[model samples]
Every structure is written in structure tokens, then in C-alpha cells.
Target chain A: MQFGPHLLLAILEGLVTASILSLTAMGLSLVFGVMRVVNVAHGEAYMLGAVLAWWVTGLIAGHPAAGFVIAAIAAPLIMGALAVASDRLVLKRLNYDPDRTIVATIGLLYIAQQTTLMSFGPDARPVEPPFNQRIALPWLERTEEGWAWFYPWGLSITSYKLFVIAAAALILVAIWLIITRTRAGLLMRATQQDSETAQAFGIPVGTVYSVVFGIGAALAALGAVLVVPIQQAHYLMGGEPLLLSFIVVIIGGLGSLPGTVIAALLIGLSDGIISVFFSPTLAKIIATLLVAMVLVFRPRGLLGKAPA
Target chain B: MLEATGLRAAYGPVEVLHDVSLTARAGEITCLLGRNGAGKSSTLKAILGLLPPSRGTVTLDGAALHALPAHEIPKRGIGYVPQGRRLFRELTVAETIEVGLMTRGEGRETRDWVLDLFPRLRERLGQQAGTLSGGEQQMLATARALCLRPKVLLLDEPTEGLQPSMIDLIRDVTVRMRDEGYAILLVEQRMDAILDLADRAVFLETGRSVETVARADLTPQTLHRRLGV
Candidate 1:
């Protein structure tokens, strides 16, 4: 393919990656931002979403859209419940001590992985897309008569992929509204700012933490549900997303939602483009190098506040 | 009335408050005075259940508070302003007050009354608490607590770092709360503030209540002997 068409395809692929990455990374960032807990099991929650999506859709019949819709709704809610249970049963008991929570979540990661392996098995399973009509894209070119448009070979995107991008954008906006405009969001921000003070003011910080954990896991699950059609569900699939999300969260600035989204775009786009031009391994290496540069130059992160 | 008796609390294995007791009655300002590390703040913490007491009973109007969680104590009509102001730095002044009122399910009337008390806060309602001047932040913290309309208010060094004018404003507000028939427990290091505002004083030394005296009995010699200032 020519450079122009190839570049366009790469950008389209990058948007899909970015869309999914933002949701996954935002979940991790929200958990860290509000609860001050690095949820190492976040990626497992994502895998559970994909696996559950497969199960839920398999349970249903008729139109693919009906199964897809049910799977999307049920998977996240289940993931959220699991997350809340872990938060209450595990993280809360640790008193949310930073070091202790990390260790606890690492334990949770293994437990989730092993449990999923036992129940769902180790096979990678694909979920059918609700609608996947491929639309050929047009390219601009100078002809003998004048400038014209033509269908470029292998330059197209699936309708489902576009839907993923649009859906992610809408979800991000909805999350932004919840954080900035609602009373629950106000309570969350209050707890994030000063939990002791929030508790003193009767904000029920523990309950808030539970709810935040549930929401964070739900978000990651939602992303997984969306991506399961393109990728396959497997117990081990969480490892890559976890590593990529950690990188995005660190580069974007810890716990900053906008920073998370922006960093996801940067990393995701670079990953997609570089994979097309060079190799996926080289893209990951470049991303790691970027994180190192960010750590050395901007340790607080792209948008993280300086320590008070 | 709010009373804490035989209070004992520890951080880790080290007891910081030992057998400290005090009473804060309605329509009066009860001050806790001592040198640093003398368990004044710890006494307040025990009362609020922030540091659960090993041996103590806190009663607010005959209801036991020590058995309750720290967050529950506030919902039972007690407000606290911790040392260092502890404001939600990112929240607007209006939002800070709203958070305080949320537990009590208060409405615009309580918010308006708090705003009326600190009119300067009303002017900066949309400003972030962290960006406010030190004096303004103190006012907002007190204002946020007041929005709860609690029967009891616990303030720990509310005037720790403020200008003379701001100090006077806080003192005036504290006095007004007293006159409004609220039970107030105050922790302070400033002798002038105690002299100006305290109806009764409890002095502490090394985690023990050394003495309890009336404002009139708090002479300079007594203050010098008890506070070591």
C-alpha cells in the first residue's frame, strides 16, 4: 500500500486501540486517584469482562445485537460486584495502606486469574460482533481532469470498530459529567482531596471507596466487552493490558483522568502506527522508553499535582 | 453537653492520651489548653472516635459516642475542624459547605446562615479552598463545619496561622456560636485567645488532665504555671 493510504489505515487502527486503551486506563487511574490503591488486579477484571461477555452472549439466541447488548450490560455489572467484594473483603481490611493494598491486589490478581482458569478454562474464545460491515474508504488523487476520489485498496474499517470509538467517546463524556456535576462526584472528590476530613464531615469514605472500586472495575469490564469481538477472551489476556495501562497511567500522570486519556492516545496511536511500520515488539519498546523519559523528566506525571 | 471521661488512646503501641477528661456544655466555650504533645488534640480525637479509646466514654446529651464510628459521630450532630484546617483543597467554598451539610441533609437555609456568618466566604464561594489565603481558608473550614448546624463543635487550633484581624473574626464567630447555645470544645495554644474566649479551661500535661479552672481563675500566674509559657 502507498504511504498515504497506509498512514490512514494506521490512524484508524490507532483510534480503535486508543478507544479501548482510554477506558481501561481511565479505570485504573480512577481507582488510584480516589482510593490511592494501585489495583494490580484491574486487568483481570478486564479479562473477566471478556469471558463473561462470551458466556452471557452464548446463553442468549436470535440476533447477534441482542446477545451483544446483553453481554455488554451483564459483564460490567458482574465485574463491578466482584471488585466491590474484593475491596470490602480485602483492600478495606488493609486500611488502604498503600504498600499493603498493592500486595493485597497482587494476591487478588492471582486469585482472579486462577479462578477464571478453573471455571472458564484456558481456551481463547471469540465473541461475534453485533454488526461488522466493512466500509471502503475513499482517497483523494490528482487526475488528468482534476482532483478526484477513488477507493484505495485495503483502506477500510469495520462498522463495529467505528461504533467502538464512538461508544468510548460517549462513555468518557458521561464519566466526565459524573465527576464534575453530581453530588456523588462531589463526595468522591472530597474523599480524594482529604479522606480524613471527608470522614469527619460524615461522607462515609469507606462506602465511597467501595463504590469507586466497583465503578473502576466496571469501566475496565466495559472496555473488555467492547474489545472481545475484535480480540479473544483468555485468562492470560490481562497481562498485556495491565502493562500497557500502567504505562499509560504513569505517562499521563497518576490519577489524572484527562492525562490518562491523552497518554492512552499517545501510546495507543504510536503502538498501532509503529506496529504497521516496524513491529509490535519495537512499538512496545518505544513506549517503555517514553515512560522512562517521562519518569526522569516529569516524575509527577503529565498532569499529577506536586506533593503537598 | 458533651463529656469525655477516663479517655485513653494510643497510636501503635504508644499511648498519647491517658485518663483525660473534660466537659463542654451548651452556651459556653470550653477550651483545652496545654503545651505541644500534651494530649489536647488526642482528647478531641478520642471524643470523635477518630482514635478509638482503649478506656473511655464520650457522651453527647446522655448518648454514648465512643462506641460509634468516627464518621457516625458527625452525623449525630457534632462538627470538627481539625488542626491545619484540613479543607478539601480542590472543592469550591460552596461545595465544601455542601459536603458538611450533606450528612444532616440540610438545605439552602443552613447554607445561607453559614454564609451570613462568614460573609467573606460568601464572596469567595466559587473559589477553591487551597487557593484561598490562610485566613480565608480558616474561615471556610469553620464555615463548612458550621453548615452542619451541629449541637457540638470541636475546633483544634482554628487560629493557628492567621493575622490579628482574622483571629478577631474567628474569636467573634466562636463567641457567637456560644451565644447561640452550641456546645464548643476548643484546643488552643494562644493565651490571649483563651483569655478572650474561654468560659472554662482544662489544662493537660503528658496525657493527663492537670487542672480544670474557670476563666476568672485563669490568672497569668496560673496560666504560666500550667501552660509553661
Candidate 2:
């Protein structure tokens, strides 16, 4: 059997898509793991990041790369602060009640979305690239018989997609290091395992919760900034990624970081490949059905252990 | 080195400790003995700032602790091992001890000292605290508290589910700490063990102090009758 150039491109695109999806879902997973809150507003945070990136680019006169850098850094910091404020003012007061936190975050999602809509309007805005249009991969060339193929530049890939992939990989590695190597990571894991016990160890568990929430929000914001150049920024852009991120989180396992990354990649690649072969509507159905099956077969997720 | 004056606490409307007054002298083990629900744990919670006293004060070396948050309470030269041996389940014994040193602004040296105190912990350092047997977890909990190098230590129901050998180890550790000039306040339902370790004892009933007994006068039968065990 012969795979066409388009099919190969679709596969590469799927990998890129998975990277974006994983970045967003990783944030949601982190919050859920440590704080046990769904953070329904996460998607809205991502949307806000994209809009902010676009806005920053506009302000700087076509400096989209700078916008990306600024938004990537600022979005998380801002969202993290927002998360801390939310935890202190609202979520913390709920006393770690899962149900109440869920409801409150859902309300927060609406507020964040509507606020962005009000500020940015409903227009889909495009972010200009700061870097010059440099083609990293030459166009694919086919043999005269139209049965064999080769790449003129040895690789047929977009520089933008490559940049997104590299950025996402770097972010994931940074997150992994923070969660595993640092004292903050130890406190985070302890708090996630049992908040009371962590507190008993003289850790300010409340502070850990706030910081974790902030970090999670920041990751979501980073994802938004990364995706802006590929997909034009819009107010409603948060909804699609939110659903996909949730599905990825669920399929990966609620509180497991490694599981979340794997699940994100799986879902993103599958969704991309399916959409290429079929319609997006069908792809969504397939992805949802996969999630449901995973839930039924292994409620704890593919790599997650059952909650104690 | 630690004092509680006119301390009162409650869960919702039901008061658990009422105007409880006690003092723990440096280099001595002071035990609070009461039957279940007699506010023994509540006193420990109040001291640790887990449950804020509605009225009165807790002082360590003449500094007020009532206004401090739970996490900050440990920084005031006080360490707490709650009733349930509240070790982080997913963390290893070493990591569990490491968390105790978090607010101390100190480093691994403190953890090394603790590990030396409970040498059993050295062998099981990498094992998850939760996966340990109940007795090992208790050891880990106390060792973790010691990592803070606290001036005073609080233990709540430390011998709740321990075997005889483990209980003896805890008793020896308590006595050693007391002899080393560390102030200790212990809440224990195991009257025999508490009597064996404590220099003095206070009994509580219905959330109020009922009596104080000198350790010299404490016998198994007397404590059994007093505790109604």
C-alpha cells in the first residue's frame, strides 16, 4: 500500500495538534490533581491568552513573535494570580467541596468568557508572524509516474508548526522538572495526596493550593498563545479546546501528569487523523466514544490509580 | 516551656475543651489522659492551632501562639503529630520527614538528625509512608516532627494501634526527648503507656479538667478506674 503526501502531512499535523492539546490539558490535569477542582474556567483562560496575544501583537505593530513570548509569560502569571484570588476568595471558602468548587468554577467560566467577549468583541482576529516567512521544508515532489514521491528540501513541514511543537515540548519538559525535582513539587505532591497530612508537615497547604492553581492557569494561557498563529484568535475559540482538553484529561486520568500528556497526544492525533479521513463531526463522535469506553473499562484512567 | 491558659474550643456549637489550663515544663513529659471524646485530641488541636481556641491563649517561651495559623505554629519551636499519624500517603518516609523541615528554613541536616533518632526510618527511607505498617507510620510521624528541631513536641494518640514492641519504642523515644530537655505534651488513651512515660498527668472529663495525678501515684488499676476502661 502507498501512503500519499497529503496523508503524511496529515500525520505530521496530527502530532502538532496533539502537542497543543496536551499543553492545555496538562494545566487542567495539574489543577485537578493537586486541588481536586475541575477549574471549568480553564478554557476561558486559554481563550483570554489567545486574545491577549493577538492584542499584544497589534499594540507592538506586527511583532507576533514578541506577542507570543509576552503572552506566554504574562498569561500564566496573570491567570495564576486570578487563580490565587479565586482560591482565596471563592474556592478556598468552599472548604475543598468538590461539588461546590465545580459549580463555582462553572460560574467562573461564564464570567471569564463573557468578560473577554465584552472586551475583545466577537470578531476572529489574526496574529501576524514576527519572523520572516522562511520555508523550512521544500514543497513535496512526485515522480513522473505519480506513484513515488520525495521531498525537495528533505522534509515537507511548516516552520510555524515546528515552532509550536518545539515550544510545547519545552513547556512540557519544564513542567515535568518542576513537578518532580523541586521542593515545591514535593509539597505539591504531598498536598495532592492528602491536604491535611501535608499541613501537618508544616507546609502551608493553602499556599500550595493557590500556587498550583496559578501554575495550571498559566499553562492554559501558554497553550492559547502558542495556538494563536495557527488558528486565528476568537472569543469562542475556548470552547472547542476546552471540550477536547476535558476529554483528554478524563482519558488520561484525572490527576496524573504523565497520563494527561499521553491522553492528549492520543486524542489530538486521533482527532486530526479522523477529521482528515472523515468529517470533524464524526471525529468528535469517535473521540467521545473512546473517552466513554475508557471510562467504563478503567474509571481511574489508563495510567491513574483509583483514588484512595 | 509551653502553657495554655483558659483555653476553650468547640466543633460548631458543641464545646470540646473548656477553659483548659495546663503547663508543660521543659525536660518533662506531660500527659493528658481522658476517655474517648473527653477533649484530649481537642487540646492537642488547640495547641497546634488546628482548632483555634475560642478564648484564652497558648504561649511558647512567653510568645503568643493563639493568633498564629497552623503552619506558622510549628515555626514557633513547636511540632505536632496529630492523632492519625497524618503522613502524606504518596510520599516516602524520607520525603515525609523532609516536609516537616520545609518551614524551618533549614536543610537536609535536620532530616539527618531525625533519621539518626529513628534508625528504623533510615532503612525504610524510600518506602511510602502509607504503605508502612501502622507501627512504622507512627515512628515516621514522630521522626518527622523531630526534623523541625522543635523546642516542644505534641503527640496525640501516638500509641493508638501499635503493637507492644512499637509502643515500647515510642515510650523510650518520649523519655529520651524529655531527658534531652525538650518539652512534651502527649495525649494518650493508653493509660499504662502514658503513665510509664509521663512525669505528670492531667485527666479530663466532659471537656473539663477533672484531676491531676503525679506519675508516682499512677498505677494501672487506678488509671483503669479513672478512665472507666
Candidate 3:
């Protein structure tokens, strides 16, 4: 492929990765931002989503879209319920002490991964996309004719890939609206700012924590459902998502929604382009170093303010 | 009316409040007066369930409160303007009020009423609470609590760091609230404010409710003797 076409393909691939990553990272960010709890099991929730999506799709008949739709709706709901149960049974008992919650969630991560391994088996499995018609992308060039558009070889994207990006964008916009424009979101932000004061004013903060935890897990599950067709599901697939999300959330700034998206895009595109041009290992090493540099110079993140 | 009896609370092993008790009746500003570390703030905290009393009963019009959690206490008709204003700093002035209203399932009518009381807040509705002047922040804090439309209102040093004009505004609000039949529990150190607003004063000394003085008996000498100024 020519340079322009190759680069375009890499960018397209990066957008798909960025979409999935932003959803996963956002889940972690919301839980951290609101409850001040670092949920180490967040990636396990994503894994569970993928596993459940595979199961649901297998159970369904008829069109591939039918199963995909059912899995999309059911997986997140199940993850949300499980997350809320864990929060109430474990984190709440631990008093959501930052140090203790980390340890507790780490235990949750292991349990979730092992449970999936045992039930779902250790094999990596893929879900078929609802629709994947590939369309050749055209590149503009100055030819003998003033300006000409020609199809670049291998410069194409599946319809499903475009759908994934659109879905993620829509979901993110919905989340933004909820946070900025809704009563539930207002209460969540209030709880995040000052739990003590929120409680003093009759906001049931414990309920809010449970809801936030559930929502966070649901978001991760949604990401997994979306990406399962692109990437195979395995119990161990969570580790990469977890590590990458931590890096993204750190680079984006703690608890910043916009920062998370931008950082995800930056990291995702770079990972794609670099892996294509050099190596995936090199891409990851560069990302890790970027995180270290961010920590050293701008610990609060690109958009984070001084700790309130 | 709101009543707390035999309220005892501790910060870890260190006891901050022991055997404190007080009553705030409707149409009255019941002031809690004491020197520093006298458990005045702790008393209010215990009542609000912020610091759950190790042993006590808080009742509002005969309903038990100490049995509930901090969040539930406010829903049982108590509003608190805590020390330091405790405003949601990042939230805009309008959003801060919205939180208060959301807590009680209140509507725009109450918001309009609160805005009328502190018209200054209406102008800065779009500004973040942290960006407000000290007086404006205090107003926002008080206005937030009032949005609850609670039967019992708790104000902890509402005018502590205010200018005289702001202090007068707070005093007037307290008086007006009291006249509207809200039970007001005020924690204060200023003699002038206590004299002007308190219908009765509860004196605390070393985590204990030592005395209760009616407004008629709240002379400067009594305040000086009880407060040790």
C-alpha cells in the first residue's frame, strides 16, 4: 500500500481501538471520580461482558444482529448488578477506605477472571459482527485532470467498524448530557465533591456509591460487548485493557471525562500507527514512558486541577 | 421542635461531646454559646448524625433521629448550614441550589423564594461557588439548606467570618426564619448576634450542656460568665 493509504488504514484502526478504550477507561474514571475508589476489577467486568456476550449470542437464533442486540443489552445489566452487589457486600463493609478498596477490588479481579476461566473455558472465542460490508475508501489526488478521486488499494473499513465508532460517540454524548443536565447527575457530582456535606443535605450517598459503581461496571461491559467481535474473548484479555485504561486515565487526568477521551485517542492512534510502522511492544513501551513523564511533570494530568 | 438528649460522640478515642442536650422550638432561635472546644459544634454534628452519638436520642416532633444515618437525618425535616460553608465548590450557584432542592424533591417555587431572600445569589447563578466572595458563598450555603424547607434549621457560625453588613443580613434571615415557625439551632460566639437573634441560649462547657438561659436573662455578664470572655 502507498504511504497515504497505509497511514489512513492505521488511523481507521486506531479509531476503533480508541472507541473501545474510551468506554472502558470512562467506567474506571467515573468510579474513581465519584467514590474515590480505584476499582481494580474494572477490566474483569469488561472480560465478563465479552464472555456473557459470547454466551448470549450463542443462545440466540436468527440474524447475527439479533444476538448482538440481546447481548449488548443483557451483558451490561448483569455486570451492573454484580458490581452493585460487590460494592454493597465488600467495599461498603470496608468503608470505602482507599487502600482497602484497592486490595478488595484486586481480589474481585482474580475471582472474576478465574470464574470466567472455569465456566467459559480457557479458549479464546470470537463473536461475529452484525454486519461487516467493507467499503473502499477514496483518496483525492492532483492528476492530469484538475483533482481526481481514486480508490486506494487496501484503504477500506467495514461498516461495523464505523458503527462501533458512532455507537461509542453517541454513548459518550449521552453520558455527558446525564452528568451536566440531569438531576441524578447533579446528585452524583454533589456526592463526588463532598460526601459529608451531601449526606448532611439528605442525599443518600451510600445508594449513590452503589449506583456509581454499577454504572462504571456497566460502561466497561458495554465496551467489551462492542469489541468482542473485533477481538477474541479470553479470561486473560482483561490485563491489557486494565493496564491501558490506567495509563489513559492517568494521562487524561484523574476524573476528567474530556481528558479521558482525548488521552485515549492520543494513545490509541499512536499505538496503531506505531505498531504498523514499528512494533506493538515498542508502542506499549512508549505509552508507559509517556505516563511516567506525565506523572513527573504534570501529576494532576493534562486537565486535572489541584486536589480539592 | 427538635430535641437531643444525652448525646455523646467521640473522634476516635478522644471524646468531643459528652452528655450534651438542647431543644430548639419552632418560632425560636435557640443559640448554643460556648468558648472554643466547648462541644457546641459537636452538638450540632451529633444532631445531624454527622457524628453519630455513642449514646443519645435525637427526636424531631417525636420521631427518632439518632437511629438513622447522617443522610436520612436531613430528610426527616432538618437542614444544616455546617461550619466553613461546605459548598460544592465546582458547582455553579444555580446547581448548588438544585442539589438542595433535589434532596427534598422541591420545585422552582422554593428556589424562587430562596432567590428572593438572597437576591445577590440570583445574579451569580452561573458562577461556580468557589469563585463567589465570602459573603456570597455564605449566602449560597444558607440558601442551599433553606431549600430543604426543613422544620428544623441548624446554623453553625453562619456569620463567623462575614462583614458587618453580611452579619446583619444573616441575622435578619435567622429572625425571619424563626418568625416563619422554623426551629432554629444556632451555634454562635458573638455576643451581639446572640443578643439580637437567640430566643434562648444553651451554654456548653467541656462537652457538657451546663446551662440554659432565656433571652430575657441573656445579659452581657451572663454571657461573659458562661463563655469565659
Candidate 4:
């Protein structure tokens, strides 16, 4: 049981990290892929989700499940609305210009962060998970002198973490379904390919940009709501999610969802194992260094398409 | 009818089309013939509002087209087959055409007609358009535009890089669309395809429409002789 328990725990932790990372990164990738807009405020959107979840849950105290459920449903919707308003009111006015959007989103990031600070107060708070049952994990140990079969080692995982993994996966699948099986997806892909032609053929590129921005923010918020139970929601919490999503997106290929998912798993697993074995700072340094190599050698990221 | 009057367009400060006026009526195939850099494409872009003409107006069936955003022009019943057959290389032929349908908020029937026009595309509907040969890509581009089922179809060099057989197919489709009452505006470098299909030919020389010839009065050789090129 020497290394087995440790490995299992690390892997479980990695999977959980990957679940939220991919969810957040996919939104970033999709928004860039379609609208060619890099949402600098993506992390702020995540914080907003956690803040909204806290607010929704606060509305009905003493009922953890109801609060979680209401927050789950309402948080993303509110995040989506906020994103749409930002796109129409800010990004659209800037003509969705790439350089301008970056500045605009940076402004948005601060606006969101400060708004929460002014209204929600500058404090870290935790939301109660709807369920928190512990499930024991099994691991094999070395007998007195030889190897033994698998045995229980008191290793366990919380039920809410399992829900995070399942929910993230379901959302990813739903996204894949929409992107691959629906007409709206076709329009998005078309717009991504040639905005002028997409427009000439009947797509309103501006409207598509607004919708994509909204979806991107909503997905990020969904990931935040799911994790708010385990992680404390704070005004300062947006920084790490934002930084990690950028790493994932850059390493996965700026506009590639599949690459984002794979890179997320790679980063998350390594981050978890490295943090456990070494310092979290060392884990981060290694990840950043790895990204540097990918940039130098494979500029397109792990699975990004080469420019056509 | 699609009528563009005194269209003056520019790329930044350099003017491309100067006071160019033309018309493509429903039920006719009108060809815009010119040499390289002759402003034929610019004229089409101006009418489609992609260039946003610096002067004059483009009206489709009497409503303003130049004032509409490029995306809204198609909704007003104008379809375009841009030069280079700009298909989304990652998308399947069906998905590419489906975009045309989705933009108009219409569905399958137009797809059926497009597939009928280019049965070659029907077999390749599931294939990525970039995987196709040059000829097949041209067909997809034309098919995508036609699937929009526009009152006016703007084709910019449909026969460029295509084989002779593919040329015949595009020529045939152009004539068919004309007979079916789709106003077609085509830009062509190939005199043969122009002669084979154009009901009226407008010769553009250095941003101006120099002469307009009816089908009966036009001969590819004589037109070439007249231009003295």
C-alpha cells in the first residue's frame, strides 16, 4: 500500500483538476475559435459564477441541496446574461477588434472583480456541497516480503467531487453534440472559416459573436458553480483560473476544444502529482516551462491544426 | 432586377471602381468580362456591400443593397460565389451548404435542388471540401451559393482553374439558373464560357464599363478584337 494509495489519490485529484480546467478552457477555446475574441475576463466570469452561486444559495438558507440546485441552474444563466450585455455594450462597439477586445475584457475583468468586492464584500466564503458522502478507494500492498493483491487502504473521495467530474463530462458531451450535430454549429464553423463569406451567405457575424461570448462565459461559470463547494469563493480567486485556462488554451492550441481537454488533463495530472511530490511553485514552473517548449517547437499546440 | 448605379469603391484611398453602373435582371445571365485588375470583382463586391461603395447605390428589385451590411445583403436575396471558391476546408460539403440554408432560415428543399444541380457534390457531401479536387471545390462553391436560392446570384470567376468538363458543368448550371429566373452576375476571364452562357456581356476596362453587348451581337473573337488585347 506504500505507493498505490498515494498514486490513486493523486490521480483522483488530477481528474478533479482536469474536470474544471477543461470546462473552463473549452469555453475560452470556443470563443476564440468562432469569434476570434480572447476573453481576458474569463476568470472574472468564473468568480462571478461562484459569487452568484453564493447569492442564490444565500436566498434560501438552511437547505443545502435546494441552494446548490438553484445556484446550479441560475448562476450560469446570470453569467450568460452578463456576458451578452458585455458583448453588445462593449465588444460590439469596439467592432470585436482583437486588440481592442483584449483591453475591453481587461476592463471587464476589473469591473467584475471590483463590483463583487464592493457589493459582495472582500472576503473568502464557502458554499456547502449538496452531498458530501465519502467513498473508500482500494489499493494493493506488498505483503511481508512479496507482492499482494488489491486491498482496502482507507483511501476515499467525496461524492461532490465525483459529481464535478460527471457534470463536466456531460456538459462537454452536450457541447460536442451541438457543435457536430446541429445547424447552429454549422453556422459557427462557417463563420470561423470565413466571416465575410459566412455573412455574404446569410450569417450575421456580429450576432454570432455575441452568442459565442455568452456561451463561453456561461460554461466558465458552470465550472465555477460546481467547484464553489470545494473551493472558497473569493474576490481574488479569479487569478489562478484565468492563468490556468490561458496555459491550457495556449498549450492545447488556441481554438481547439479537443486539444484543450487533452492538455487540461496533462496539465492537471502533472500539476496534482508534482504538487504532492514537490512544491506547488515547482509544479507551476514545470508547466510554464513545458508551455515554453511547445511554443518553440510546436507553435500550434498539441493538436491544433496547422494554418491552412 | 439588381441595379448598381454610379458605384465608386476604394480600398482605403485607392479607387477600384469609378462610377460603374450595371444591371442583372431576374431570368438573365449577365457576364462581367475584364482583364486582371480590371475592377470586375470590385464591382461585384460593391454591389454585395462587401466593399461599401464610396459613391452611388445598389438596389435589388428596387430596395437599397449598398446600405445593408454584407451579411444582410444575402437575406435580401443576393447570393455570392466568391473568387477562389472559399469553402471552409474543415467543413463537409453538406455542412458548407447547410450554412447557406441556415443563413436564410430555410431548409432541405434548396439543398435538394443544389444537389440536383451538382450531383457530383451529392456523393461528396460528407467529405471535407478541401479534400476535393479544384473542380469539385468550384462546384461546391457554386452549389452553396445557389442553395441560398437567391433572386440574384453573383459569380466571380466560376471557371477559373476548372477543367473543360467542369467548365461545361458551370456553364450549364449558369444557363439553368438563368432559365429558372435567377439574376446572375458573373465575372469571367475565359471568353469561351462567357460566349457559351452570357445573355449580355458588360466589358470592364480599368474600372469602367466600356461597352455592353447583347448575346446575339457578341462573339468571343469579335469582343476580343474590339478590346484589342
List pairs with backbone clashes in candidate 1. none
Report the C-alpha lDDT of model 1 over B173-197, residue by residue, as the tens digit: 9999999999999998778776868
RMSD of 2: 3.0
Candidate 4's residue-wise lDDT over B98-131, tens digit each?
Answer: 8878767778888898888888889998999989
| Deviation (Å) of A27 in candidate 2 | 1.3
Q: lDDT at A118 for candidate 4?
A: 98
Higher-scoring candidate on DockQ, 2 or 4: 4
Enumerate the candidates' DockQ scores in order. 0.83, 0.58, 0.85, 0.80
Interface C-alpha RMSD after superposing true interface residues, each candidate, one decimal:
0.8, 1.6, 0.9, 1.1
Assign candidate 2 its CAPRI class: medium
Considering the two chains of model 1, state its CAPRI-style docking category. high
lDDT of each: 0.92, 0.83, 0.93, 0.88
Runs in model 4 deviating more than 4 A are: A141-154, B12-15, B216-228
* Candidate 4 docking band: medium
Tell me, what's the RMSD of every candidate?
1.1, 3.0, 1.3, 2.3
List candidate 3 stretches off by more than 4 Å. none
Could you say which candidate leads in DockQ? 3
Predicted structure 4, TM vs. truth? 0.94
